[model samples]
Target chain A: MPKSLVSLLIVLLSVLFATAQTKSSSAPSDLPPGSTSLIDPEDLLSELQSQQGEKPLVFNVGPSILYMQAHIPGSEYVGATSDKQGLERLRTRVKTLPRNQPIVVYCGCCPWSHCPNVRPAYNELQRMGFTNLRVLYLADNFGVDWVDKGYPTTKGQ
Target chain B: MRRIVLVIVVIAIAIAVYEAARHSSHAKGHPGAVDSPAPQFSLQDLDGKALSLANYQGKVVLLNFWATWCTPCRGEIPQFIEFQNTYGPQGLQLIGISMDDDAKPVHEFYQQFKMDYPVAIGNANLAESYGGVLGLPVTFLIGRDGRIAAKYVGATDMTALQQKIQSLLQAR
Candidate 1:
């Protein structure tokens, strides 16, 4: 091939390679930090179940009431999305749980970062001096990751 | 009387300008893109019952995206079941599309909750089709024409849902 043609081919391949890299890099950032952890789902499941005896406070917050229809057993409803009133509701709910006790928070309203409710609720709890606060960031929405994980769930009201 | 009329006219113009500006700004934010079509799919329940988007033709379908491990998703299920039971016969269909991987827990969850409506396992392609669902219990209310009427990304209200459904049913 002529030198000019060979150069053109190289440029096109480089552009394609660069585009591929950009797409691949974006995936990791989309996942929450906690999700990257290799902790066994079974362990998480056991912890969730064991907490049943102690009933470590688990709170669900968001604007979607449909979230309440099916959720982790013994978890409490915080609010409808992470709006101002929902934040206040979370504060009151957190006040009832022991400060030292385990508290897990999640909102499948959307993604964890964009969720108006869950992060604020979790952050507010942290601000209120709650030590054990962890957010379960599911890959898709809550249904795909958590329920699919085989953790316990209950339905309705 | 002339002064008052001038003042009122000015106020009206101001309000119109403000609204016009706001509307224009929102249009820019939308990037001049046509509305994207909502994702559609069909999956089977554990009982071998097939639930398809087409089945809900001419009815507003509330599609709930959730998982079993999600507390919010769990909490929402019972209310959804209630919603289904309360409105199922009323042209309102509540479909729980679970994004669960393993079928065992979902099967158990179905039995435990005694859910009357359909619950099915969600896969990657389905999630992708639904505009990359990000959270648990994300809900989309598709209107009778099958366009997404409204989408609630988190925990939604039962009363609000009922009202929306009623209004949509009326519209249809």
Candidate 2:
């Protein structure tokens, strides 16, 4: 009922509200600043389907099992970037490409917050000076975000 | 009086936001599988022992596709170990299919967690057989009759999953 008590309560409530917003938005916190390197599933699908302009080289940086089950057609499997070997393979794959080449990487192995692959791959590419890299934002996983959405996919090695 | 009302409103909004975020992160449960036959697979466990779906026939099976590197999958392991201990005698068989690229971490995880279920390294074929396991922590509940009962994707609601397992165990 006191004015001071009300002011304290308001401050506490503001902190709580701010904390909630931070936690909810933490899913993309691992991404690059501004999350400008991220691409939505729908946008990537449109780009793939349009076949207009210079086509980006799409890479699957998740597990091979998921890649074999379903993946964006024509996306090269770079293995799980969380592993040492997978990272090496990714570097090898892109070593010859121009630094400015349009590239997209995705790892729909789990939720966006939990994916252990994409961040590493994205960081590696960034360190390698790739300016045109984009990480596909699969909020859930591939099955729910892309494959289940009826996006074009092909299963195989 | 006005301050009290403002505090109440703020509290209510905070609670709403918390609940909404919690539910959104919880596993998305799929509609019950149309009683389709459970996909059969024979694989070798960490100990190189034969682990097969047929081995658990006539029992309620909780087939979980996970990987050691998967954070949500790791979160579910302890609860699953408890489930196996509590429900093993009740015809509940918890089987794990690790989708990890290697089996070494899975082996370590198995011992560290004291997992009571049979976990085998999963392959692309095995994943595809179950309608494509394109994600981590995908779970399938199979009835005693070897038919799929329910499927859950992402981090599941453990309470609801336990209840479902109980019902399935009671069915036969």
Candidate 3:
């Protein structure tokens, strides 16, 4: 089979898997409560296109290099949640924004299951009572889901 | 007519750029086995100099893949620094392959740790060559002969690492 077809299959599988997780009786078990509001890649892309003025604040809680290479347009880097400085940056970033402001967090440096940055960042916002938070499901990485799709991308830190 | 021609030209350029970027982005499969020869790479160091793996041949090279954000990687750096101090003159070469994307934070970490070795920006391609470095603080010990000696996936033991380096340094 062609490589493109295989890649599309993998992306499709990732989307399906992320959607399936929403219906699981139990959460990931390891992750915290209220961490399952996953924003599908297609859905997020569409939202970015349609919503102009009231766009949600997107945060790339991944590594600096990934952000520098490419990132969802308008997303801010608040450091890696695995680090003390990162968590503090997140805490500071959320202070000015309204508690109900729509927020999406992502870190496609690793697989979603093993990503050290996303969950902690997600849970931290949740602990702060930010109900309008969602995770951008990056089963592979940002390059595959977002960048490869020709979505809005901005490089440089 | 001119607008249509312009559109076609733009699309062609876009496709060419996309294909080129995609082809250069990824490498095929793993870089090979531990016993096999190590991949030669030139990566930018803290001082913006090119540090090459092959440049350190004839010395036992400790190629460490680490991130500033990783807790275990922080703990392991002290040992590496100590090893470099003790065995650097004895033909042990330590190179840090920082998994961090930004050099600013790593520079601060380097100063905090007081590291004396060269640290390069690590990429997925290089990590995958060492049999897929999925975790932090993964290290590869390269023999003086330029073949991989051992690959450690987590926080490396000081005593064991020292012993291995000692043997490699003394081996005829």
Residue-wise C-alpha lDDT for candidate 2, range A84-143, written one tens digit per residue? 999999999999999999999999999988999998998899899999999998878998
Q: What is the C-alpha lDDT of each candidate?
A: 0.65, 0.87, 0.77
Model 2, B41-140: lDDT tens digits are 9999888999999989999999999999999999999999999999999999999999988888999999999998899999988887777888888999
Give, for candidate 3 chain A, the lowest lDDT window spanning 10 residues.
A25-34
**Error at B66, model 1, angstroms:** 1.0
Q: For model 3, how does the per-residue alpha-carbon lDDT over B1-172 read when each residue is reduced to its tens digit?
A: 5565587589989999988876444333335356678888888898889899879979999989888766667888988999999999999999998888667889999988899999988876676556445445678899988888877755678789888889999985
Give the Å error, residue A7, model 2: 30
lDDT of 1 by residue, A52-75 (tens): 555456677743333534576777
Fold similarity of candidate 2's chain A to the true chain A, as a TM-score:
0.82
TM-score of 2: 0.82
What is the Å distance of residue A50 in model 1 from its true position? 41
lDDT of 1 by residue, B26-76 (tens): 232232111334456788977889978888788878888776656667888
The prediction achieving the highest TM-score against the true structure is 2
Please give the range of 10 consecutive residues that has the lowest summed lDDT in model 2 chain A: A26-35
Q: What is the lDDT of residue A43 in candidate 3?
A: 81
Q: Scored by Cα lDDT, where does model 3 land? A: 0.77
